[model samples]
Target: MDRITLKEQLEKYRTPYEEESAFIQDFIQLTEDPLAFNRERLAGHFTASSWIVNPDRTHTLLTLHKKLGRWLQLGGHADGNENLMEVALKEAEEESGLKNLRLVENSIFDLDKHIIPERPHVPEHFHYDVRFMIEADLTDKLVISNESVSLAWFTFDSVVDMIGYNPSILRMLEKTSKSEILL
Candidate 1:
């Protein structure tokens, strides 16, 4: 979709947490810029992510990010794609080497704007991330990709401890409760 059309039609969802709600507003504002959907916009750009869980929702898959050296959900730059849902699915499939993914809900599951540390030729910038919930089999084989140092699955409680109790990641864990997952 074209930038202007997308800017005028971005979907807004309810997030109880103040931080997430604020991020949604900022995400909407980001769309005002013509380059917001493209990775080439160095200032910042949209990224889509998937909070991948097992089919039974008993575990979550995380990748040890190569650059940040932290376990993170699967995702990548939108690359000018205005359909974030599709982008999230594509990133999940590429990063985890998992197939036959299913969306738990076809809506925004979480919103995050994190700083991307500076690299050789890329300066630090915010990633206005839109996340979605995805499901796959726990028994499926996973192939690590170039973007990660490692990849693995863990229970929700295990993830809570593994990430060193990070607030945002904690928020996602809290949001993905059993009741919500069952829906």
Candidate 2:
């Protein structure tokens, strides 16, 4: 996706929570910049994440992020990939080593705007994260990528109890738990 297409997608996205309206609008404005998808944009940049759940939605796959030292959904910098859905799929595959995972939906499952702490050479910045729901078999073999300290499948209740400490993660989990959840 190019700038126009990315902007269009952001414009079409609707968040159920009224408080998140600001994040949606900010993402739209960020897409106007030529460097919106580039990691080099220190102010902020686009990223894609996969909320990987089992076919029955009983469990989710989470990686103990090496950089953050916290269990997080699989995702990564967009680099120059304007198509976030492609980026989400690629990241999920690369990070989880899960093949033939199904995209539960083609549209956005969640949107989060958060700050990325500064690393040695990288300055702190915000990530206009676009999340997509994905499904994988529980019996599938998973290879832990170097990007994570470890990976595991957790029950939805456990995820809510563990990661729900973070408001953003809590929001996503709450959305997934609902039977009528939409993109």
Candidate 3:
């Protein structure tokens, strides 16, 4: 995942949202250093996350983020790994405690850039997050990690209502709803 390759991928990514499109353009322009995944790089860092669904696709997994206290999909810092797909998978498995997870596609499923407020020792910075869809059995045992206060599965409709109508989550639900990817 060199800068050139990532730039190409971002260019090819199609999204109906103007904000996301703008984000892609900005990410391409701002990310020049190969250490784009390191938080110390400061410009911003790449993150990988998963929109995980059960086998039936009727419910999705979300973690109550320990720091933010918001329900979000499982994911974490890239830790310098350029292969974001692998990062998404590893984070999903580690955070969800589900062993049989599989990627819905190798291509990017969603893109977002959000500001992370300053923490104890960490300064305020943006997270250039790349998200992917993953599938897992609902019956699989789920173990919550220290990073999360709790984990749960929620229906797409319910999630939208519960999470207070996030456009990104709705966009993912809309995309997956019509595709065979969820099946």
Best by lDDT: 2
**Prediction 3 TM-score vs. true:** 0.92
Assess the local accuracy of residue 23 in candidate 3 as a C-alpha lDDT between 0 and 100: 80
- Give me the runs in candidate 2 sitting further than 4 Å from their true place: 180-183
Off by over 4 Å in 1: 1-11, 181-183
Q: Residues 110-131, candidate 3, lDDT per residue (tens digit)?
A: 9989888988888888899889
Candidate 2, TM-score vs. the true structure? 0.93
Residue lDDT tens for model 2, 93-163: 99999997999876888888999998999999999998999999989999999999999999988986766
TM-scores, all candidates, are 0.91, 0.93, 0.92
Q: By TM-score, is 1 or 2 better?
A: 2
**For model 1, what is the error of residue 81's alpha carbon versus the real structure, in angstroms, after optimal superposition?**
1.2
* Stronger candidate by lDDT (1 vs 2): 2
lDDT for each residue of candidate 1 in 125-165, tens digit (9 for 90 to 100): 99998888999998889999999999999898688678786
Best by TM-score: 2
Q: lDDT (CA) for every model shown? A: 0.84, 0.87, 0.85
